[model samples]
Target: MIKPIIRLLLIAALLAPGSAFADTEYARVQFCWAMGKFDHTIYFGEVENREDRQASFDDLLEISGIDHHAVKCNTSDSTSHRLARAKLLKDWRDSEFEIVNTTFLSDLDY
Candidate 1:
């Protein structure tokens, strides 16, 4: 039980957009590849511009090649087979983008 939890945390931390992996073209590709290969991953991004946020979400899905729709969900769920809305968790100036609620996975996905 503890092992699974620790592994999940480690995976999340590794995939997270940390200072070590700045958002660059190569970084985006690497992130997308890692995300596609991982069965479980949750990504959150903060951008001030709404248009940029939307574009980022599109890129995230496109680069990762995950086919999905916006559903309603929360962070407390232990299962990934749930519905959740993809919206900003906080204010618009600092938006939160989640791409973990995907319904369809491309060939590249795990």
Candidate 2:
């Protein structure tokens, strides 16, 4: 009975569109790989929900910390892409904490 219920839940998740990505916002920004440099200027105006994009951008800023805490990006381009990881939690317990996956993109290939 438990197996059947678990299977049904998995099926439901797969059938739901936008369910996983509903609150998962994306942004296009200039980025460099971990240990790399940030001298490029990529655009980030193609994301959806322009009215609410700023909030997402702010979230990204906190995740990357701009010139502070940042993780390795997921893209090979390095000049134009998306952040590989993010941590939205303002406060988390030491034992309950986990590293947010990091990813990014750029355009100039620099």
Clashes of each: 6, 16
Cα lDDT, all candidates:
0.31, 0.28
- Best-performing candidate as measured by lDDT: 1
Q: Over the stretch 15-110, how does candidate 2's per-residue lDDT look in tens digits?
A: 332223323344323222221124221112223222323334334544544542232222112122222212111221122333232323221111
- The residue-by-residue lDDT of candidate 1 on 1-110, one tens digit each, is 33533543454453343323232332111111123333333443332211223344545565766544431112212111111112121221132223343323321212
lDDT of 2 at 5: 27
Off by over 4 Å in 1: 1-38, 49-52, 67-110
